[model samples]
Target: MNDLGRIEDLPADYVEEMRKVNLVPLWPSLRGVLPPLKPKPQTRATMWAYADIKPLLLKAGELTPIEKAERRVLVLANPGHGLDKMQASPAMYLGMQLLLPGEWAPSHRHTPNAVRMIVEGEGAYTTVDGEKCPMSRGDLILTPTGLWHEHGHDGTDAVVWLDVLDLPLVYYMEASYHINGERQPIKPDRGDRAYAGGGMVPTPIFERSHKAYPMLRYPWDEARSALLRLGQDRQDLDCIQITYVNPETGNDAENILGFYALMLRPGQTLRLPARSPSCVFHVIEGGADVKIDEQSFALTEADTCCSPGYTPVTLHNRHADKPTFVFMADESPLHRKLGVYEVRN
Candidate 1:
């Protein structure tokens, strides 16, 4: 590659004139925008232990009340993106949100799509577009763009969940905002029950539902059973994984990000190929070791970590007698939509 001319090489007066006209030279910064080979992502290999986060979260609950805080959260921001930006990757935002007993987070809707992965506690539920979805350990609940959602807790313990959102991308497009709304009346039916079976769906011969999101909540019990069945049936497979999809359309659960559940057999080590989309991993059960580039993270239950794009990752089950399960969120849908998705061995 030839060395491009530096901005300093240009005449000082000419540079000032271009600056005054709101015009700048491209050659000096062309390589930065269009780098050679794969992209130079700012997202780094980072991890956050639940053990370290829980204490501070409980302290936050004691310090602030629900009325003043609205949603009490501690962001899991990536150092590569700068802590102030509150982003895990270029396109994803992660935060650990807490709700104490008898608390209710008011209803509101935002332009960015969001999901909640329940980390601990019980008797907490999220109401989205009217349907009330219960929160349990390992459950995933979706709050798509422009849909009203709120959280409430009935149990006597603290409820915490990992929140994943495409806020950076939506904010970058200048379409990020939220509208507060009054409390919603609970609906009669839930989407998960309507589409529980794998190969079956409501016929809707008389009338079809026009809602964009047919399913709002995915139970952890169902997902774990599916993984166990897959592992039993496919003993030869190295990686036991399942993608969360829209049962009616067989597409990714959400529009912008891909969600998956991965199971590692007892004492198994799985190597995932380098892919174009950055990924976030959260341990749901057991313990595991995650390696990305030169960084390594020992993730136990409720621990979260992220890896950049164009880098292969390795996962190893720390237990020798039992399996390990992990929840993963990635930017594949956005990458594919932009026609740049890739996987390299």
Candidate 2:
């Protein structure tokens, strides 16, 4: 394409008049907003090591009390978006939240949809809309938009979890805000049990659940078992993966983002196709080397990495003797909703 006229080429008086009237020429910066082929994403390949973040997180716990901090968290900010933005991708926000024993994070509801991927420890439970979902390593708990959720710990150790949210997108739309509330009454129903079986869902014989988010907690044990079974049953499959979805509707668990569990067989190396949605991967078990574009990240257990959109990612299991499992969060749902989702071979 020919070079477009630069803003500097415009007449000084015309430029001055346009500036005075708050009008700006688009031809000079047109390519920036409408890049050819694919988007020029600002999100870069970034990794946050658990080993390096743990010390700082623990220190943050000592520095700030739960009473003052509400939710003691250290954001896993991507440098591409700038540290101040506190976002891992264009639409996703990631943070490591620490909850010490005998502490409680007050109940509140926010417009941004969020899910907690338990990183370590036990005896901590997140009460979402009155259902107390126990926190265990690799467990996923949802605090969807407009749902009241709070955290409490009863065990003797500190519990930590990775918080993934669509805060960046919601905040960008100027619809991000929270409403504080008193402790919610414990509900007798547990969504995990109601939707436990894979091929079965509760039949609405007597009564049906009207809530949008019927299942809030996805136990890691079940997810891990499913992946192992899938890998065992499908030896011909190159990439063993499972999507976390609503058992009833057979759709993504949440509306804004997509959650998935991926397993790499022993000595397996899988290359994901270049897609239009950026992805965040967190190691749940074993180690894997993630290569995104020109950057490679060696991620151990609990380590997390982010890859920009429209980039192919290669995941290699570092362990030859054992299988590796990873939890992935992506902007595919939002992208699809906006009619921009893609997968390039």
User: Residue-wise lDDT of candidate 2 within 136-171, one digit each (tens)?
Assistant: 999999999999999999999999999999999999
Pairs of colliding residues, candidate 1: none
True lDDT of residue 229, candidate 1:
100
- Candidate 1 structure quality by residue, lDDT tens digits, 76-154: 9999999999999999999999999999999999999999999999999999999999999999999999999999999
For each candidate in turn, the TM-score is: 0.98, 0.98
lDDT of 1 at 113: 98
For every candidate, C-alpha RMSD to the true structure in Å: 1.1, 1.1
Which ranges in model 1 have alpha carbons more than 4 Å from their true place? 204-209
Looking at model 1, residue 282 earns an lDDT score of 99
lDDT of each: 0.95, 0.95
Candidate 2: give the clashing pairs. Answer: none
